[model samples]
Every structure is written in C-alpha cells, then in structure tokens.
Target: MVLRLFVPPGEGQHYIVPKRPDPLGANATLQYVVLSSTALAAGYASFAARHERRIAPPTKVSRTALFIKASGRLGVWAIVVGAAANAYYHRGFTTVVVSQLVQDPTPPKLYEKTDKYTVEDGGLAGAAAGFIAFLPTLLMRRATVPWWTRMVGMTNIGAGTGVIAAHAYFQYTGERQKAMEELERQRSRRMLEFHYIFWDKLLMQRLDPLLQAYVRHNGIFRAYHVPAEVLDAPDKYGILSMPATEPSTTTNAAAPEHAPYYIAAPDWTEHLKALNTDFTQSEIENSEREKEALLKEAEYMAYQLSLKQHAFVHSTHTNDDDRQRCIRELQIMGIAYNRLRASADEADRRIFAGRQWLRQRAAMDANAPKASWLAEHPFIPDPEAHDPSMSIAEIRKCEDQFKIEIQVFESRVRSEVREDVEMRERWRRDLDEARTLLRATDGILWELEKKCPPKRDVGEVEVRASAVEETPKVEEPPKSLNPEKP
Candidate 1:
C-alpha cells in the first residue's frame, strides 16, 4: 500500500493514502515546462545557426558571450513564466484544489490544532515562500549580453510572448479556429521575426569575437554578411561569377607566418574601396560617352532633318511604303531620345548613390548614427538611439517595430532598383534601335533622291532655259538641215 507524508504545523505524520496533488503547484510546473520548452527551442535555433556545418567552421565562442546569451534567455523565461504561472494557478487551479479538499477522507481527529491555518501563520508562511521566490528575481539584476544583443533578444522574446499570449487568449475564448487561420495567414511575418532573432542571438555570440578580431587584425570592423561580392565589386550591383583565385606567393615580410586570417578583412575592405574608386572613374568615362552619344544623335538629326527635305517629301510623289517607313523612323527617333534622357537622369542618380555610399564609408564617425548601425546590422534599428532609457521589455518592442520597418523598406528599395535597372537596359536598346533606324532612314532618303527629284517652279526653269539659249533660234530646222538624211 502507498503511504503519504503529511506535515502539520506542529508535527509530521504518516498516513496510508495516495499522494494528494497540489493542483496549483501542478499547474505552475506545467507552465514552467512550457516556458522551458520555448526557451530551449530558441536556444537550439541559436546553437544550430552558430554551429551549422555547411556555413562555416566552428569559431571560438567567448564564455562571456555565451553566459550573457544564456542568462538573457533564462531570465526572460523566468519572469514571463512566473507571471503566467501565477495567473494560471491563482485564477483557475486554486479553485479546483479547494474544491478537491472536500474529497479528503481523513477524520476530524486527524486535523489537529496544527492542521488549522490562521491569519498570522498563513502570513508567516507566505513571507517565507515570498522570500524563497525572490531569489529568482536576482537573475535579472545585470544583463549578460552586449547592448545590441539584448536589444534584439528582448524584442524577439516580447513578440514571441505576445504570440503565445494571443494563442492562449484565443484558446481561452474558444476562437481556436480563428487563431489558427490568422497564424497561417501571417506565417511569414511571424516566422521571420522569430528566426531572425533566434539566429541573431547565435550570430551575436559568434560575431562579437570575429568582429573584434577583425579590428585587432585589421583597423576597422567590416560588418559580416555584406555579401562577399558586394565588397568585391562595390561599383556594380551584383556579384560577378568568377573562378576562385590561386594562392599567392606574395607575403608580408613583417607579418607572422602563422597569423590568422586578419588579411581577409583588409583585403575585403580594400577591394570595396577599389570598387568604389573604379565606380567613380567609370561614371566619369560613362558621362563622357553619354555626351558623345547625344552629340552623334544630334548630328544625325541635323543631317537628316530640314524643312526643304520635309517639303520635298510632301510635294514630290512618293510610294506609300517609303512614306510609311520614313514616318516609322521619325517615331522611333522621338521615342529613343525621350528614353535616352530618362536613362541619363537615372544613371546620374545611381552614380550619386555610389558616391554617397563611398563618402559614408570613408567618413564613418560615431556608432550612434543610423548609418553605423546599418553597417553593423544591415537592417536592424538603433534601439539606444531611439530610447536610451528603454528597459529590456521596451527595447524588445522597439526591435519589433524596427524589424517590420526594415523589411518593408528593403522590399520597396529592391523593387525600385529593379525597375530602374530594367528601364536603363530598355533605354540602351531603344538608343541602339534608333541608331539603326537612322542608318536605314539615310539609305531610304538616298533611294528617294534617286527615284524622285524635287519639283522646280516653271519660272525658274524658263529663266534657266533662256540663259542657256544665248545663240537664239538654233531651232531653225534641227531635222530640215539634214533633210536628205530624214
């Protein structure tokens, strides 16, 4: 037979019965389990992203970083879980426990004076329990991660917590179907924020040391994940497909043979700088070429266009096919010039952006600015700048807001850039077509000059005839003078 131990205020006694479950305590335990599971999931995502084999080899993670990461996860979990557990236990499980007390079969004699709970005793016991509970509160006293990681994590956790709370609320209110539908509909947004922070936590742990090493090895911190090709070809928008380079025999004589890959940092930075320079140089060359192209087009127009030629075409007899062809070439030229102007304007804008980017990188100042933040994060916002006094919870809210903003901005920028590139390409094609048409129009005009000469006025022809007939009346008998021959 199973026996249960019962502790009265005065004595501990043994009784034969099944162990009574404290429903409130059980509910609290369950809530803890849920919290732990969520925390563990986040941890696992962090770990996998940091250590994934396909991406990069394992880099040394600083103990400080790991501790800070774990501590944030643990502390956040504890507070949120504690509050949820308390709410669940007090609101629902406590009533069930009190109702279940009536099912206890012990006699009145079993309930000694110690078994009764009085106000003073309950208060004393509660004070002890509260004192014990206060220990977990100390964990949140100091943050373990860097400010940025804390900013990102807190934001992620808050969003995740809201999602969980919303789910729970839906379940409580018997709107499970609606909740499921919403979850499915907004799955990408939810998943993106969740995973971004999840991976970001891991990256913060890995990147801090890497970035520090970059600074130590090289003079500056080049943000990781700024596509290798972006640095490789800063002048261009996309990466060039290239073969891998062979190892070089050149070496820095002053450097240690076994020095870790700090060279990669400067090499990349220099490449980007070179690309920026190249882009500037290319822009100058392109501007010159654009001027030449426009001049050539203007010359072609000067040679082909004139009131005399236009009047000749309308006055002189011309075939329908030739007339239609001439009109088509004129239409093509007009469209080409209009598009070329647009393309030229767009190219100037792109060139300006390139120059601005170069200037920004060259003159990078304090880390407080948004440019500096984007260099580090590429897309995340500056929480400290937004609200220096924000708590972890508030930082999290800020993070969510920033995340959404960044995504939308990125999408908009990408679409606009794509359209711009396409427009530029289309303008080039149109310019080429116009050039071809101009050549074809020249050939057609040459054929027209041969086939149909311009009409002359009768008065002008008579004057020309009189000037030629200085001898006068040599027409006496062109054929009669040689009548014998006729």
Candidate 2:
C-alpha cells in the first residue's frame, strides 16, 4: 500500500496542542540529514579532487585506498541517515503495538496522566494536552512509567541533530592540505637557518663531497616513500634495472701458460668456470665503466634514494642507529669521488680538479642577505663574505627552535601513521607531492646538465705565462732539511 503524506487527525487531539504535521520535528530530521549529507558530500568531493592534480607520473595508490579515501565518510553518513529514518519509522510501530495505549478517560482530580500516573486513569490527558503533556519532567511521583526513559530518548534525538549539524559545517568549510609543500618549505627554512649545524644529521656532507663534482648536486634532506608502481617496476621510472656486475676476471695474469686449466689440478679445474675464456681485460673494462658510472647524476641519485628508502621502510635500526647506519652507507658513495682525480692522464686529473673547484666556487658564491633577529630569513649563512659565526647564546637559541620543530614533526608523523582517516589522507597526499617533487627535481637537473655540462678539457682552460716580458722569479728563504712540527 502506498503511504499518504497527509493523514486525517485522530478523534480528539491525539497529537499534542499546537499540533503540526511534525510536532517533534521528526519529519525535519529527514530533511536536515538530506541537506547536511548533500553539503558534506559535495565538500568531500571538492576536497579530494584538489589533491588529484597530475604530478608528472601521479600517485598510483591501491584500489582499496582509493575507495576508503573516497567513500568512507559518505558511508558513515549513510549509516546515520538509516538510523534516523529507522527511529522515525519505528514511531508508528511503538504507537500501534508497543506503547501503553488505553482508550479509557481520566478519573477524579487527575486531569494529566503524568500527574495521575495509574493504569486506570488513561493517557487521554497526555493526548488531550498534546505530546508536551507526556514530558518526563512533568510526570508526578505516582506515575507508573519512569521519567528517565523519555528523558533519555529526547537526549538522543538532540545529540544526533547536533552531530549532523557539526559534521555538515566542519566538512563544508574545511580545506584539504597534503602539507607536502609546507613540509619541504619548513625543511628548507630549517636547513637555511641551521646551514652548518645539521650537516651531519642529514648526512649532506657525505653526499656533497662525492656528488658536488656532478651538476645540480643540491642535497635532498628527506626520503619519500616510493610509489608501488615505481617501486614494482623501477625501469618504468627510468631507473636502471641492471644487477651488480659479476666478477669476470681471473686472479692471475691472462697468459695461456698460466691459464686456470693449465695451472690448477684437473679436479680443481672441474669446479672452475670460464677456464677456457680469458675475462681479465673485459673484467677490467667493466670495473672502469662501473667507476665512471659514479659521475652519472640520475643513477647516483637513485642509488642514494634507495639507501634512504630502505632505512625508512625495511631496516630494523631505531632512532640514532638507523641514521648512523644510513649515513655510513651513504658515505661509501663518496669513495669514488677522488677516483677520477687519481687518473694517470694529466688532462683527466686537471678536469676532475676543475670540477671540484667549480663545486667549491658555487658553494663559496652562494649568498644570503643579512637580517636582524626579527627580520625575515634571519641568521642566513654568508659563505665568502666571512660573516662571524653564531655566538654560544645564538647557537643555543637556534637549537631550542629546532627542538620545538622536531617535536611538532614527531607529533604529526605519529598521528599520520595511526588509523586516523584524514591523517592518512594527508600522508598519502604528501606522498604524492613528495614523489612528484623528486621526479621533477630529477627532470630539472637533467635539463640543467644538458645545457651547461661539466668541464672536461684542461687545454681550453690552461693559461700560459707571458713569454715576451721577463717576469721576476722571487725565491723564498731556505729551510732546514727537517721541517718544524706544529
């Protein structure tokens, strides 16, 4: 049977006085929920969309994550809608089959059922007086029904209404932020402020000594979580998939007379591989090529990033131990820095030295404006200008500031890692932002290197002393054979 919107009024004021279509605002609950849900859903859609802007290769989160991130709030609101609708629907059930209904009229002095409260004097007093007559607070001491039951029901309705209102307002005006840009901005500010102090904390010194010879060698102090797509198929992200090179050379010289098969016993030779083929020269070339790869910016960055990722994702080391281990591994990347400088070729040696000098010059040339304590970009480092270092008190001040920042960061990370949905969204959004920045930075550096390549030839830069004019050769004082010790 189709339900009619308008129902005929019952015999005599079955609805309370000042009776309307919905005296308890029961009908209004449905309207309110619908409006609030619409507003909140719209707000959530807008908020989620803001985070989906393409960042080169955009974030490829899992389907489950996408679903939860998208529809979780909507589902919760749907439950509230169901509960409110069910409660209203059950009003008819309670009125017909559940509520204590009596047809008899009131007796004696009691005009109100709440005041009379006995089974014999019917609830027509409440019905005649309107629903307000049944209020628990109005009930007299003689009432059979407890005042608390009605009181509790009223409280629930009010609480649910308040919840709906709160959710609607909160969702509509809320701004969705990944906080990725903000994090990097803060990190940049910190590095800029404590330029020299935290060099060891992030292991930048280890990287700088090796990578400064390469172009666009600025430090990335933080490690970002690699997207599953990129991590699963690294080659797709332009990362080389080659395994570490295998040993291809024999231990001894590559002479047929001293070949492994010729020198070793037959039983031992049986175990030896590639006995017939000479691998010494190829192995040597492979080793050289491997050393040369140290100069490749992209490959070097990928390697460094992998170490950091492992420390964050897979490693068991905690706190300072993790940092120390990661840094030590990172330092190993620097051993190859001086390898080019040690080349026997004079031109090669000079080129490597020139590259090192270029790096030093860049660092020395970097300038920041001096500012007072309260000014913007305060305590900026002055490299070549030889500005005085921070005094003990200034150092202490910066350290205190850093401590506070660290605490805030720790709190944020803790919240994000827990099961808080909004926090998780923030984390995911930040992850996407971080990944985009990483890829974009690599792209920028790639373009920068293409435009202005490193110094490769010494002849072009070599300056010959003027031969036409006789330059005076000045001699210094002669020293004893033994040098003085400090």
Candidate 3:
C-alpha cells in the first residue's frame, strides 16, 4: 500500500509500490498516506534543527514551519512526477495490447491481451490512489516537532538520498555530517571569542580608570561608593548596537564617574554596553589595584629621571649654590612623588574593597544606603565642589599632616639607603684586608728567597762582599806610622 517515489536527476523518477492490498482499495491508499507523510515530516524536522543551530535566529519565519513546507513541496513534486510516468506507461501499453488482440482474433492470444489490460488498469487505479499520500505531509508541516527529532528527520532524509543516489552514499553522508558539525563548532567558538574581546575593549577598560581614581581619593579606612550612573550609562548607551552603526555617543553623559575630565573613546562607550551585569567586587578591587600599581611605577620612573637630570646639570655647571639648590629640590620632589604614588595606591585599594563591601551589603539588604554613599564618594568631584574655600587652620593642619607623612616615608627610605651603604662598606673593608694580607705574604716570600738562595750546579755558596777585608794589612800600616813618629 505504501508508495515511495524518488526522483533522479536525468532518469525522471522511480516508485516503490508496496505489496499490500485491500478489497475496497481504501487501506492501500491510507497506508501510502501514512508512509509519505512520515518521510516528509522527518525531512522537515531535520532541516529546521540544522538551520537553527547554524544561523542567526529568524526574525519573521519560524524554522520548523519553513522546513516542513519545503519538505512537503519536494515530496509532492516527486510523487506527481512518478505517478504521471506510471499513467503514461499504462495507457499506451493497454491500447497496444487491445489493438493486437483485435487484429489476431486468436482465442488464446485474446485471453492474454485481456489479462494484460486488467493489470494495466490496476496500475492506473493505484496511481489514482497515490493522491491520498500527500495529505500527511501537508498536515505535518503545520505541527511542531522537538529539536532532536528534527535532527533525526534530517539525518533520515540525508541517508535516504544517499541510498537512492547509487554512488558513494556513505562517503557523501559522512562528509556532509562532519562539515555541518565542524561549522557549528566554529560558530560557537567565534561567539565566545567575541564576547571576551568585547568585554575587554569596552566595559572593563573604560571603568578601570574611574575605579582607580575613586580609590586614590578615598582611603581604605572609610566606606565609599562608585556612582550608579557611571555603571548604568555603559549598559544603556550602546554605541556598538546603534542604528546605521554610527559611533557611540561621546558627550559628558557617557563619561565614567571619577574621570569625567578625561574623554572616552566612542568604541569604549559601545563596549561599556556589552559588559556583563554580574561584576564581582574582587574584580573591581583587582582592577583598581593594577591601576594604582602602574601609576606608582610611572611616578617612580619620573622621579628617577628627574634625579638623573639634576645630577647631570650639576656636573656640567660650575655654580656650587645652584648645585646645592638643585640637589635639595630633587630630594623634595622625590619625596612628594613617592607620597603621591603611595596615596594613589592606598586610595585605589580602599575604594575597590569598599565597592565589594557595598555589593555584599546590598545583597543582604535590598534597601541599603550604599547608593547614597557612592554618590557622596564619586570618583570625580562635582563642579561646584571643584574649588572649595578652606580656613587657615585647616590648610595648616593639612600641610602638617603632609609634612609628617613625608618625613616618615623619607626616614624609612634613608634608613634603607644607609643600610645598603654600610653593607657595601663592610664588603670593601673585607676586600682591603684580603689585599693587604696577600701583599704581606708576597713580601715574606721574597725575603725567604734572599736568605736561603736556591742551590745551583755552580758549587757551594760563595760570599762576594762589597766591603774590602783589611785584617792582615792593618798591623803593617800601624808599624809604619810609629816609625815615622819616632
């Protein structure tokens, strides 16, 4: 009863007529309907599943409907072509057999001709019955199927196509499956990569400076908050997703909390929107810490450069007072630079920690006062508070604190330097003692060589004195002197 039609590229189409019969012919038609419908439904399911996974979400058409419709259309075309071919064959052969029977008029041949006609009529009737086959395919197109089922349907269609093709079915099927899987995997990888890069370039980098600045201004001893607008603007102001892909807004509204004075890049504004909402306290703290560390490194480098420049100038110039003044200024500048770097680092650490604390606090109490605390502790100052008047006493007190802090820091640095110098001096003294001992050893060796000369092949040691020996001649000289006196 099941009639399966497969179309070939050039040979028209082939039909598989099932060997089931019904006295009323209704059963045969119904079975054909069921089989064809199942095949078409399976094919559509497979196509939809593959499409959804590989491509972007469709805006208008649902994937399932599209697949079902396409599959049904294809199935109908195959059946129509197969049925038409069967009908032509039946009609032409029947006419030829009847014409032969009329000319011959043999009893036995007539009987054979009648029998052949009956078979041809039966084929025609079956093709007519095949009309019912298209109904199931039509209905399935409107119904929804699970995703996995859709994939299975696609696999079945692919396998069925391979079987009917008569050449390299398994190879083609394997290759297609592999290619599709690889393509899906690649797409997933790309999505993940884009997510990470987008976060780095847009959100994290933009917010980093603001966080650091906040920490630099506020100490770890006190609780502080970064502004909500600073956080929310990035989320809402999506430059990357804008219509016509125009650059992100660069107006003051897009600027981060503390670093309003600094201009943000259009790209950064876009990135800010793409950042994940679930930012952790540790992450913020780490970011601030890194920023402060970099700032300190820069300050240290600058101080070193200044010191070198001052020394170079002093060496070239002949003025002693100018050199002394330059040296003093260098020392003061070095101290100030260090203090600034330390203060900036400390502030950053505190702010980052405070932000973390605030997040935790908010989690504990839905109506927490953390937001207000953040507004008061903005990374940047309000325009009105930019230049505030201060009393003399307050200014003096501030100066005194700065002085005390600087003095303490300088003293520590000096102590470290002194210790290093002392260590070097000790090493130098040890080296000097070693050198002296070596010299003394060399001198003693030289004297030993003189006192006990090496014995050579010449003979016993002979003393060749520089002074003349006058022992025997002294008596003769004295006698002559006495005779002369007498």
Candidate 4:
C-alpha cells in the first residue's frame, strides 16, 4: 500500500499496508471537484447577469452599461476563482506528496518520480476546470446568444437563466410593437381630420363677407339705426296702409281684423333671423334647446300665414270698404315683397360663393396623396405581409361619404336658391297688376265724390262720419277680378 504511491512491488517487495489513511479525503476526486466548480461559476455568472437586467432601467444607456459591467465583473470573478481553485489543488497535491515521501521506505529517486506525477496531474485538472468556469465568456462572444444570456452550456441553471432572458427580450419586443401601432393609429386619425379641417376652415373664411351682407340686408336691427326721415315716411302712410281692428257687436259681423298670414319672402327672412339668433346663442350659452323643434315651428308658422293670405286675396265678394282694407293689406305685402327680392339676390350670391369654395378645395385635394400611395408606399414594402392597413380603408370610406354629402348639399342649395329667384320675380309681376287695379278704384271713388258733393263745412263733417259708418255694412256684388288664386 505504501509503494502504491511510488511503484509496484513483487517477490522481493513485501505486501505493505498503509500506516494511516491517505491525507486527502476519499471523496475529494479531482475531476469531480473541477466539474462542480465549473458548473457553480457558470450559474453565478448567469444569475448575476439576470439580476442586473431585472433591476436596470429600460433606457439604452442603462441596459448597455449593465451588460458591459456584468461581463467585466464575470470575467474578474472567473479569473479570481479559477486562480484560487488551481492554487488549492496544487497545494493539496504537493502536501500529500511531501507527507507520503517522508513516511515511505522508498528511495529518493522514487520520491522524485511520485512528486512529479502528483504535480502534473493536479496542474492538468486545474487547467481543465478553469477553462470550464470561463465557458460563459465564450458563449457571450457569439451574437446569437442575446447580450443578457451570457452563460454557456446546457446545464439546468444556465437553461433557467436563458429562459428568463428570453422572456424579457420578448416582453420588450411586444411593448415596442404596441407603441408602434399606437403611433400609426394617431397618424391615420390626424390625416382624416385634415380632410375636414382643410375644407371647413376655407368655407368659413369665404363666408365672412356673405355673413356681413346678411346682417346688412336684414332690416331687424338695422331698422333701429335708419334715418328719422325713413321712419317718419312709413309712419305717415300708416293710417292709409294699416289694417283696422274693431270688435263687431253683431254675430254676423267679421271678427276683429289682424294682418293676414301669408308665406312670403319676408316670412323666410323671419325664419332666417331665428336661425341666426339660435346659432349666435349656441356659441355664447349652454342651452339644450333642440334645433329641429325651432325649425319646425318656423316652418308651421310660414305655412299658416300662406293659407290666410291665399284665402283673402282670392275672395270674389268684397265692397269698396273691403277693397280699401285689401289695399292696406297689399301695402304690408309690398314690404315683404321687397325683403323677398333682397333674399333672392342673396341666395344667388350664396350659390356662387359655394361653387367657388368647392372648386378651389377640390383642386387642392386633387393634388394631395391618393389612396394608391397607402397600398404601395415608396418607403415601405407591401404592408399586407405585416399588420393590415385598416386606416387606408377608413380614409377612403370617409372620403367617399364626404363627397356624397357635399354633392347633396350643393344640389339642395342650388335648387332652393333658384326657386327663391323665380318666386320673387313672380311676386314683382303681381304687385304691378295690383297697383293698376288700385288706381282704377281710386278714379271711380273720386267721380262718385264729385257727383254727390257735401253742402257746407258742418254738414261735410257729418256726411263723412255717416259715410265711414255705412262703409262696413255695405256688401259688394260677386265679381272675380284676377283669375289666379295666388
């Protein structure tokens, strides 16, 4: 057993037994120890890198610095631990050699050989172990193993660490993908908004002059600012032009007179006035009043007025006094007729303005990017292989709908404006015919006055009073003058 440390002994050599147990522990196998330390070092490096990655900030600088710093620390630790392990084995083997050589009965020549074998075995084992410990560095050198996965080999610990690193990488990529999608969505939304904003702002700018004209042409507020002479002239004619309202004592008598309801151009002026008032109020107030209700009310009022005017104008039986009342009613209609004429002119102007606005904006849109650019952009490949470009479809759909709406709006505005023009022209022709008839009635009244002239000043006043009193009672023969109902 003692020669076992040096050389084998036969016939001349005795079967010697060990005096004491071997100095090195039975379980202290050099190869096993080297492998264990190598695995431990690899695990430590992987764990260190993973922990650092977890705690590090998401910024580029922080992550890059963390990897670089971790690699450096790992290298230093591997070097230190490798040196220590090598030194430990070397010392253990050297000590065993020295102790055995002293106790052995072997010659000095055998001692040199045993000591040489011990040193060489220990050095080789130490070198192999140190190389295993530094295996992580080699793995990290490759680009395929992500920066965070710096550890080498397929040991359980290394595998676990690699899984964690992969998980982190995938998470980062997913977050980046989401952010990119959000950015793309916002870009698409803005592009659609541009379509509306571009046209709407232009329309507003073009309508400024028309808005000023609307205020100027409508006499509501402007009436208050008119010259005193203009006000006085209308008041002077009030006695002749105004309809008299009186309650009749008899049941058969006509009810108290009021202005006849007629849907005329002036009626539209009132409707427009209400619309403008509501529009202005909406800007300044927080009212919840529905626009549709207000519009319906205006429309109903205009319809009722038109019916009343039609009934009065076409009535065939009316005395001189009733005819006089009709003349006064016509004066009110004349005022409305003038307003209608102004409105017709305004409508024509609006049609022209809208045409100009649409023309200019259409040209601008024609110059903008078309749908084909989205399908095959110059910068990117066919986007279909990646995420679907739903934005392109959305834009096209919105654009088509907008075009249809604009066309409908334009057609309606044109039709309505032309109708207003025609209606006002017809009103002017009717007014001329009515004036001719009024002059003939005045001439006949004058002739009757000359034929039955009053005698004296006191008697003339009594006669005038009697004439006014008898006027309402007198009924005229049925005679249709103008054939037209309106």
| Candidate with maximal lDDT | 1
lDDT digits (tens) for residues 356-420 of candidate 4: 33333443446644442222246557533432223333333444443454454344435646555
Report lDDT per candidate. Answer: 0.39, 0.34, 0.38, 0.36
The 10 consecutive residues of candidate 1 with the worst lDDT sum are: 10-19
Per residue, candidate 3 scores C-alpha lDDT tens digits across 314-414 of: 67657888778777777776776677677666656556554644554454346556444343446546533332222222333433443454454344434
Give the C-alpha miss distance for residue 12 in model 2, angstroms. 60
For residue 421, model 2's alpha carbon misses the true position, in angstroms, by: 49
Least lDDT summed over 10 consecutive residues: which range in candidate 2? 11-20
Model 3 regions lying over 4 Å from their true place: 1-283, 295-299, 302-314, 318-343, 346-356, 359-486
Segments of candidate 2 deviating more than 4 angstroms? 1-145, 174-486
Model 2 clashes, total count: 3
Q: In candidate 3, where is summed lDDT lowest over 10 consecutive residues?
A: 11-20
Better of 1 and 3 by TM-score: 3
Segments in model 1 whose C-alpha atoms lie over 4 Å from true places = 1-275, 278-280, 295-314, 365-486
| TM-score, prediction 4 | 0.15
> Could you tell me the lDDT of residue 103 within candidate 4?
34
lDDT digits (tens) for residues 1-486 of candidate 2: 111112222211121111111111212333344335444544554655556554212555433233223333443465477656545443332122112222331211212112111211111222223235236345456533245433332333333444454334433543112122222333332322222323434332333332322212222233223354543444344332121122321122433431231112233223232221112222233334434443454356556667676665666666897678777765555444344334323333334433433333333345323322122223555433432222322333433443454454346546735456445444444444444444544555344334332432111111212311233463532222112211
